[model samples]
Target: MKELTKQQSKVLACVEVYLNKTGFPPTRAEICKELGFKSPNAAEMHLRALEKKGYISIQSGSSRGISIVKSQQAFEKNVNQMPVIGLVAAGSPTLAEENIEKRIPCDPSMFSDSFDYFLKVKGLSMIDAGIHEDDLVAIKKTIDVKNGDLVVVRLEDEVTLKYFKKNNHNLELIPANKDFSTIEVDLREQEAFIEGKSVGLIRTH
Candidate 1:
């Protein structure tokens, strides 16, 4: 494959992330918004360049018809295959056999540590950290986490992503967004426990 320009590389990464998250390509307008392009035409131009470079295939006249060429996957063979876990009921394991929705391909080198799975973010709690709704958060499975770490925690059966902070008395789950209130769990009474630490994020347009 030919080298991609910086802007073209951003566009290609956006498309690849979106495809890995949703199993389909993004629309031109989506690409424009994601890359901060002034117009969809700019996105179209980048897509054309990507196609010319043999990175992606565009289906003429079809909306959201972009597809990554199979050869591209060959280059990403070292990428990790992580399960995208869905809902976790209170008292159940975070990656229980029944909670897995599907597995998605992730670039392992994106993080320093290997990830156990991906969790589909569902709310605006972590928006200040640029984590948006529907984003895939890569989680390294571990119970050992420190203060100020972005972690996946289970309170009883409910699971959430928050900045972890703990003291002698209680655990604080801090939300990045000001609109949401911080969660406080009593260390002695609650069933709260760290499931994993968030190592990376994959945002789709």
Candidate 2:
């Protein structure tokens, strides 16, 4: 295998990251904007170098036509793949096997800790935290959490993402946005369990 130059390695990393997030290769203009290149020609040159080194396949005259070659295995070893479970409502298990939609590959080194899985956010309740609808939120599997920590909670049969708060005998699931009401569950009457803590988030433009 041929070793990559610094610029070629950076371009390859960008391509892999884009492919993992969007399931498609980025355009030359997109690469230029991402790498702060003055022009698309710079991005083109880097892409050509990557292809020449057998790291990627580039289809001419096609937008977003780049594809990873067999050499990508080296890069794959550095990433962590996690399942993207479907939307968790207000009363169910977020990690239910049936709710698993697909798996997403991401660079775990970008985060401070290891994550158990990814959840596709489905509402505006956490918009203030920069978590929007359809964003992929990385969750760490742990029930040990502190007050005001964003967590995935199972309230009866439903599940929700909110800031957790314990008040004497009650549990409060606070939403980041004021438009959404805070959920207060009486621990004596209903069971509220912490599913996991949100560690990081991924959004695609």
Per-candidate TM-score against the hidden true structure: 0.57, 0.58
Scanning candidate 1 in windows of ten residues, the lowest lDDT window is: 70-79
Could you give candidate 2's per-residue lDDT for residues 117-180 as a string of tens digits? 7888988999998899999888888999999888998877777889999979889999989899
Which digits, one per residue and each the tens of the lDDT, describe model 1 over residues 33-134?
A: 888887999999999999998667899999898877523232343245456775354553456545766656655666787777788888889999999888
Angstrom error of the Cα, residue 129, model 2: value is: 1.5
The runs of at least 3 residues in candidate 2 whose Cα sits more than 4 Å from the true structure, single-residue gaps closed, are 1-79, 90-97
Worst lDDT window (10 residues) for model 2? Answer: 70-79
Q: How accurate locally, in lDDT, is each candidate?
A: 0.79, 0.80
**What is the total number of backbone clashes in candidate 1?**
2
